[model samples]
Target: MRIALATATGAAVLAAGAAITTVTPAYAAAAIADIKIDTTVSFIPPSGSDSIPFTVKVNSPYTGSKAPDIKAEFWKEGEATTSAGHAASVTALSDLANTTPAPTPASSVEVKGSIPVSSSDKPTTSTGKWTLKVSAYPDGSTTAVSSDTATFEVKAATRVTSANVDPDPVYLKSGKEVDVYAGFHLEKFGDEKITDVRLESKDSDDYYSLSTGLEADDSYHDSTSMDYSTSTGSWQLRISISRATKKYSFTKAFQVKKSGSSKAKSKITLYASPSKVKKGKATKLYGKVYRGSKAWSKKILKLYFKKKGTSKWKFVGYVGATSTGKYTKSVKPKYDGYWRTTAAATSLTSGSLSNIKFVDVK
Candidate 1:
């Protein structure tokens, strides 16, 4: 009876040891989650406040209906252990119902948040890299199932301090052709450092795009021609300025009217040699072109004709002004019509069209 009792006691001790070993491994083998953080704005600006947009993804096969809680601590790159010291931190508790978990062997949840920041994170002059320490824990537990870190360079701020249009006139010249000159200055943009400058007309379907050329230090100017019809009244100059990192824009109001020639201002006049003429008779027509008080020598003048009581004008013929800014043409009238002329645009001028006059033809 004593031997049997000793064997029974040894067997009980061995069973207890086996049970302890099996339970230890089951707890150790339990799955933990994975963590990742992605940020939208890589750097914190110097002056203006901006959001550090980020998404945190939690991954684990056994992460059940309860979503994991996330926390982020920001610090300079070398100080990974500062989280325990209590640094700038943000926490988020994900509502499981609001999240969509991936349908796979492993579950994943996406949590999005933004950290508002400015020069307060670090000095604008500080070139050191920055890092964010991230951790994921079960919704109700302080113990983390996963942890990670992400690093980026915090760039300095760049801005457009001041912008102004340089004495742009309200009324630009328009006639046979239209030309406009626009200029601006960026007080902060250094000489020729500005990348692009654009001037657009809001009222006309015209492409008046231009860029700056050699000019006074730090000043920009542009000159280009546009198509402005009679229907064009007030205009808005849509101006855009850009650098490598930032862009700025604004608009200005203006007007356009038929002022003068493309090059020098000129007055165009047409004359019918005879006050009255019979139909089918050869009659002489003449015109003299004047630029400000002087003659616009040697330019083409195209004449147009319209039948009395008709609004449509038909092309009649063309003539070249003489050195004295005078031209004469002989045309045999076929019917009663109104006559007019316009100085055809040369490479130098937008051209000028004379006033319309009715010729009495019997």
Candidate 2:
């Protein structure tokens, strides 16, 4: 009877062990392998209904039939722990169904969303760094499987809407001074201070620069001297506005016309002594410079030459005038070409070009 009872208990134990061994186990859940975030803009402006578009890409090894959901949030770098509504929320992306099955390394899907910002959401600082956090979660699940963070900046938007300089054609008499006025209208999106304002010349030879603080009414008025000794030509007034971290520049063209009777017109007379010369032989070229009827003595003149068939003139050399305003130079002929001399404008005299002379090479 004892042996029979033991045999019965052993059979029951064997049956329970067989049942436990045949039971199926649950598979592991899908997990995120990689994640990234991108945006079309680097910074957000403080005003208007600006929609900042962004894309979130999630790479996962999960072979599940349902795709994961993506969530994005934006906040100031140091204010991540602030109360609700302190950060901008990205609109939820549409649900995607995973098409890639098992045996593939990973499956990647992109989700897009946007964050709307306006003047009401302005930050405390003028310019501050902001962060965006993106997370991936399984379909219908609140727990995140992967996460990523990206950084950008939020800055004030500023621009020069309108600008102009008074007296487009500035008329100045010889040995006289003139006052030039500049005005600007700015369009700003947020609170930003103008640190400096400046007006300067584009030409190094006709150099004039002035810097001043911002005016109460945004009217930039300044004066500079333009006397008989000031070089005359096309001049540019460069307006530069400086902020804390950025500088904006604009330009306006203005002409300076000599108005006084002292202004003289210059002239040049040029000739090649030997009209025809053998190749590689020396020929003499002479010229005279005059300011009105008087000799413009001790002035430098530029000489240019062009081949018979070419339209562009090439600078060959320069010659200096003597005390009597006479200049002479000798050159070896290589090709049949036309020669001419030119005088640059001075403070009191206008520029002049000499008549073209042709030299024949034999």
Candidate 3:
């Protein structure tokens, strides 16, 4: 079959009997009539100087014995005829499977190359879409026999998303002194630097914690010592974060209760009847549950035991406090170990815990 070359049109004519087909896995079958071109990233950030890789696969099915030479060029969309607008240089591949740029190879073909990006291609400067044209030509001809064009968008520079806010509660009762921590997560996208990050106080409740810059992890965090006010109610903790192009406000409502308002103590204490005991002997454990000065009755308590040198505590048994606020549990010793107990929390009272007691096993 004799194929005609449209020298004047700059397009190589494909023989009717043999045609080049482009296979796009995602799209319907369409014949390119000669060559196929694909890319890794179709969207380039206008403000980014990142390189985009392209793969040009040419099916060597032609009447002539000479395999086609591939030419890869880049230009603004709709300007395929304007050769001066092209940005990539053709590099000959040492092997047929290679995909990067290099000088024309003497006997092989390379199809992979990257769209060059530099200071001039800064995202803000070019927000329009561009296209890459891959054309196949006979060894000595300038006319393209089969060609394919891949389009990509140069997107506007995108800023980081929103900043997230979080509060770490210290759970201090009124009249108790403690510290509270809050975090503002800053966002940094691409090569975009977080020029400035500041946590502005939105309310007095959040004034205790303040941050003006990024942490080691590019996050903003603040810690302040505070205590519950003299009442039982809710207060708003508000904070705002400011960045290059966006500001986000976050608020959280936390409850503050007067000291002694709840039956729970700042910390619970654990006690055992015998500090030392014989192996296989049962040791009794007890702890007083008090809400302020009043005994909190019938509270379920979990018992924990651990060996002196071990790092973890094992659950041994559970018991309930009596109406007089006293709780007791008896455990047979399997070995020498330390013992402790924790009172489960209730709606009206905070949980209590007993001190660790070591029992010597004989």
Query: Could you tally the backbone clashes for each prediction?
Result: 1, 1, 14
Q: Comparing candidate 2 with candidate 3, which one achieves the higher lDDT? A: 2
Please identify model 2 stretches exceeding 4 Å from their true place.
Answer: 1-156, 186-204, 217-219, 260-338, 341-351, 355-362
TM-score against truth, every candidate: 0.37, 0.40, 0.31
Candidate with top lDDT is 2
lDDT of 3 at 173: 55
Candidate 3 residues 160-214, lDDT tens each?
3333333322355545666555554544433334333332222122334354566
- Root-mean-square deviation of each candidate, in angstroms? 18.3, 16.6, 16.2
Clashes of 3: 14
lDDT of each: 0.54, 0.62, 0.53
* Least accurate 10 contiguous residues by lDDT in model 1: 1-10
Residue-wise lDDT of candidate 1 within 150-256, one digit each (tens)? 66665443333334333343334344545566665444312114544555433233334567453555565676665434323334555554434444455566544
**Cα lDDT for residue 95, candidate 3:** 29
- Quality of model 2 by C-alpha lDDT: 0.62
The alpha-carbon deviation from the true structure for residue 167 of candidate 3, after best TM-score superposition, in angstroms, is 21
Which candidate wins on TM-score?
Answer: 2
